[model samples]
Target: MGSVTVYGPPISTAVSRVLACLLEKDVDFKLVNVDMAKGQHKSPDYLKLQVLSLPSPLLLHHRTPTPSLLVLMSLILTAYADRGNKNLLGRNGGGPAERAQVEQWLEAESQSFNPPSSALVFQLAFAPRMGLPQDPAAVELNQAKLAKVLDVYERRLGESRFLARDEFSLADLAHLPNAHYICSAGKDDMLASRKNVARWWEEISTRPSWKKVVDMYSAPPA
Candidate 1:
């Protein structure tokens, strides 16, 4: 039981990640809705509470903007990366090592997979809702980038079956929402073409925890 304040618009992959973690741990937290649709996330109230200062990477470089998804991710790990039995992250201080590996693969997922693919889906789906037209060139670029990431995932998953070793960890949890979002945006059949990644996804997606996070709350399409 933690007084966690999750500040972000619902339906984002990041929010999904945190929600899945809370469900898995059977922990309760308050959800603050910063409707990105109405520009609430960028408003001063939300920004002061959730995005007050720069994160660890470049403390002085204020020019670099922090993504809300990344911020929520950090919050999730900080809260649930510990605790017993529900310690899905790892065991003991070993959880630390595993947690670091989780960070590694999650970074890979975000850098190599999430950005371009998400950009494409956002442009096709959310942008239009936000009064922007679909840009075909961006769509193509996103598809190409996703293809390369899938190729890498296909190989990596062929070995371990999950991002961490045999057991489930926050690493796998972190990517689930992104995977769901990407697949739901009509990339399921496309990304599923990768044998190992597809197999891996099959295993993780079935977890009861993920369903609560994924299907329970999705932002309605505008």
Candidate 2:
């Protein structure tokens, strides 16, 4: 626990994901805000890390990918996992196979939940920041996508409280940011209407760690 720095914009779901894990584990870490608002990700120093066999974002389809949050998740889960705290994986039968299955579902959640949800954020916040057309259609389309994702969650919740097993696991923690963001963005009724999902979210969102992140986002950015 020397110092773990997350490089990203001020209000990114990826950063918030890491913050959720840190808060859950009760780890004291520092937040090194790499202001993407000022385009620091394109700097020479940052670029050199990739060119010199460092963990740089390789150009993808001629466009670089965004800052990765998986790295942060890796760090947190690795640190937190232990023989005594094995419940985080899956108790009563958290064998290797179970962990692998848990990982798969969590990855699926990340892929499926993030795209449209983040797009919604772009419409509501980023597009306007960059002087883009945050049109009604764009917003509605992204929201529609999110509504579908929530339906999936609602179905899953009918079976269990959390996503990965009967109890909370990395998958549930991984989803909190996106789900919470959706709820906070005036989509609360949509989430609340899904009885099981609403109850599930209410329970997870109340966790001490998640509460810290929620507090930061309680006030909408002006």
Candidate 3:
């Protein structure tokens, strides 16, 4: 099998999501850190490997680069079918209904969950850690937005153990990195308050794959 390479900082939630998927798929891969503070991701070499117009955390397999998380997960699944882990996407993830549902929730994570969670992480955690000023208004706004999104998730999760279904899928995995950050930012109440949402978070966030990713990025004990 061709080797996999992931390019992005470990602290990046998107990058962490990709890493978690790769780990869950049991794909051997190398991680190349991109220094966003130094604008390394904007370098000419990095831009060529990435779609440039889309997003960061490019996945490269045998020199072919793809920016789609779905594509990245599919590639790993295809390469390792003998590993017998077919449920990540679902039974025949390519099937019309399953594919659509998975894609829909994936979109929700990207559009709905990520934005506000990112805002909260930046304002509440990243800024203070970087000695930058946190914006109270931005923090409040994102907190409210995240609360609303979680409310929807609580309802949806109450219907199903996982976002795409009772089985764990990429849809639920996608939320891990950001949701972990939200909790780390001392906003666990957002999740703890919602029984179903908290249950869902606990289930996915404790996966061995995510635990490895967390250890990889965790700060050293003081």
Which predicted model would earn the best lDDT? 3
Write candidate 1's Cα lDDT for 1-222 as tens digits: 335555554476666676776677666655666566687666675555433432211111122334455555454455555642344555553556776776788688767876876786687657776898888898888888888888988888878868776667777776776677667767687567888888888988999888766565664432
TM of each candidate vs. truth: 0.77, 0.77, 0.89
List lDDT for all candidates, in order: 0.65, 0.66, 0.83
Tens digit per residue, CA lDDT, model 2, 21-115: 66666666555454565776677765553434323222211122233456546555565555223455567437897687678778777688778
Clashes of 1: 0
Task: Tell me, by TM-score, which candidate is best.
Answer: 3
Model 3: lDDT of residue 211: 94
- Runs of candidate 1 with Cα error greater than 4 angstroms are 51-87, 91-97, 218-222
For every candidate in turn, the CA RMSD to the true structure comes to 5.6, 5.9, 2.8
Model 1 TM-score is 0.77
Which digits, one per residue and each the tens of the lDDT, describe model 3 over residues 97-166?
Answer: 8867888998999899889998888887678867899898998999999899999999999999999887
True-vs-predicted CA distance for residue 129, candidate 3, Å: 3.7
- Supply the TM-score for candidate 2: 0.77
